[model samples]
Target: MTLRWSTLDTDAVPAWAELTNLLAKVDRTEEYYDAEDLAEELSEPGFDPELDSVAVWDGDTLVAYSQLRVSLALTYEGTARAMIGGGVHPDWRGQGIATRMFDEMEPRGRELATERHPGEPFELRASGGLEDDPARPLLSERGYEIVRYFTAMQRPLPGDPLPEVTDPRVGPVTPELAEPLRLAHNDAFASHWGSAPQEPEQWANGMEARSLRIATSRAAVADGEVLSYVITGQWVDRELYISIVGTRPSARGQGLARQVLTASLAAAAATGEYDLVELDVDSVSPTGAGRLYESVGFTPVRTTATFAKADGAS
Candidate 1:
């Protein structure tokens, strides 16, 4: 069979739900994502659909595709570019199309214009993940380095394990405190690498247009002030995705994050829609997040790498 790889037209790629359904088939699962979920993500500010997509064709059929995000770099390297969602259809494997797809992407990423921030350096940050399956080895051959390991951790449901707490510093979020919790959520994540400070409209616009499952959001309040939180959301398919977990600087050392996480877990378990919860943590957070997660029953499932092709540099 002859194979051809080409740039994908964001609008022409099969709908998100279709691609997701195909992915489920490749992985031996019935799980997949809906279009609205990714449309909202792509709807976010700074999302340029054209410059970030790839597709493969077999005489008139779209068989494989990829999508990536490009953002400013704030790392020691001063500049970075990121790539993700690069996958080959299960039927199309073993032909080296994925590798050629990588080779196919570099020239385009480099020639495209770069955005400059006066005080920050320019860099590339490319990331992609493969399940614990047969195709993972291509990452190394493509010059991708495994700089981070992430766990799609899960916690058993229906039995809430609320930790005993006697501190006057923690409490649940009330309607009046939602705004402050949002602010704290942003500030707490400032120190996290590759994280973008979401816009204020995120809480309302993004959530209201979609099901953010506000019922599961957890928070930690102190002296009538909201200090930190983990904005939680559940999916329609009974899978709980831990959207983001954060703790304000002033509330960092008090185990407030854990308490908030527990609260979110409890809320998720109560819904009876999910039997597990999942979140990703950097392997290198100074906060020892991975260890903290493992201590709470999260186990490592897979690891991913960040790769790059310097501007015209080998």
Candidate 2:
């Protein structure tokens, strides 16, 4: 196999988009990109297209490309981790292209990330459908260990039939209550796995940057304090992604979280904004958030086993 690896340009279209479309036929269990995620990930702030990205080519044919992000992973600590992947066009599979791409990506990820966060060790993170997918096994052979399992759950919102949402305690989020919402978010997610405390300024700036479908975010407040809230992401391609939902410890038993989530989904259904609502939950969480999502019509669509690989391992 003749191979040439080059850095991916942010402005240029990535090969992963088309490769995923082809992979969809072969791997029916996995959901790669729903159009929205593809566009969003490309535009996301942490995405550095110049030094960290790579494209694989064979005789001028665009075979695959890997995208990398350098940041602190919520699931892992201290050391650096990279989220990288590339797809082989269906017609070009079974060749050494994919393997060659992976071999190049690992060292390149280390070089780029180590330069940014000096002296820290670099790590690689990969996710797979966990059901004998070729990519998963290939990664295991590359010294990556499955460290976490994530459940991608979805709730179908077409029929507009939600559980009773009249909890009286739950209502729409407002500008005045943003701070309290942040507090609630911190508290509710604190006990959950990989939860981190983020600043309110970043949170507000995030929602302000895009069409958050802001009118529908729900909150439960009592005694001038926010108890719980659920923020809804606008469905760009018929797939509504729930950005975040949380409830403080003082509010957990009140069923406020469910009410807020129900109300948010109901609103999404009403606006004809999305047909399916989706969110990911840590399977190890003690809060039973997975069950909460399931009870609200979200079924586990796929599992991505997280793998950790030390850079330049022996």
Candidate 3:
């Protein structure tokens, strides 16, 4: 088979889909990215398809892919960062493909950083599952270090009876509540590592994007203030995912998060539309969110570690 490498194009959808299916099969999970998700990634305001991504073909079949995605808004001023996420087909692993992908990505990532924030160092980031993840060694050998660990947790929604939300103001999030919820999110996560305060446009283009419905969202408001919120994402069959959940700092210890999450889950169950709810939490979160999630019946299913390398590292 002839091995050829080139930048990704929209026409390669079939090959990309095949690659993801193969990856999911190898990992023994039903998880797979649909075309909608791909379209959403490509639509990201900061993404530059030609300059930030690559794909490798084996005799006319795409077997490996990579992309360097730079965040337009810096988490910390004077510091620019880009996240690298891609996969090699199971049959194509251990063939230097990952290394080659990194070799191609590092320079492009650095160039974009230099252009965006001159004189600022570029940090290349990637993540891999804690066990049986092929990206781990390639990243480590390239000088990337584990900077954080995150746990993907899930809870089955068996339509169990839910606790009543006593807060009179607790209810579905509406148009008027959007801005306040956004503000609450910013305030809630202010102390998180690597968090950047988002501009309105950025926030809107995110979870509140038109294509994603927020019907399952719930919030707690008191005295015209949003105390906590649970914003949901587009539903995939029977699974409902929470894109963001937070309680304002001033509302901490008021059981607001629990109230909102429980309300959201119960509402989802009431519709008989979902069987599971999922979210990821920082393993060492300062807010002890993992415990909160556990109290709500969410259990850690897997751990993924974020890895970062200095610019120009080999």
* TM-score on alpha carbons, each prediction: 0.77, 0.78, 0.90
Question: What lDDT tens digits, residue by residue, belong to model 1 across residues 240-310?
Answer: 77777788887778887777777777777767888777777777875677777776666765555455444
Q: Output the number of the TM-score-best candidate.
A: 3
* Model 3 / residue 261 / CA error / Å: 0.7
After superposition, which runs of candidate 2 have C-alpha atoms over 4 Å from their true positions?
1-4, 14-16, 29-43, 58-61, 72-79, 111-122, 158-160, 167-169, 174-187, 194-212, 221-226, 234-236, 310-314
Error of 1 at 189 (Å): 3.0
Q: What lDDT score is found at residue 294 in candidate 3?
A: 87
Q: Give me the displacement of residue 299 in model 1, in angstroms.
A: 3.8
TM-score of model 2 (CA atoms): 0.78
Candidate 2 residue-wise lDDT, 48-75, digit = tens: 6665567776765667777776553332
For candidate 2, the 10 contiguous residues with the lowest summed lDDT are 69-78
User: Each prediction's Cα lDDT score?
Assistant: 0.61, 0.70, 0.79
Q: Pick the candidate with the highest lDDT.
A: 3
**How does candidate 3 score on lDDT?**
0.79
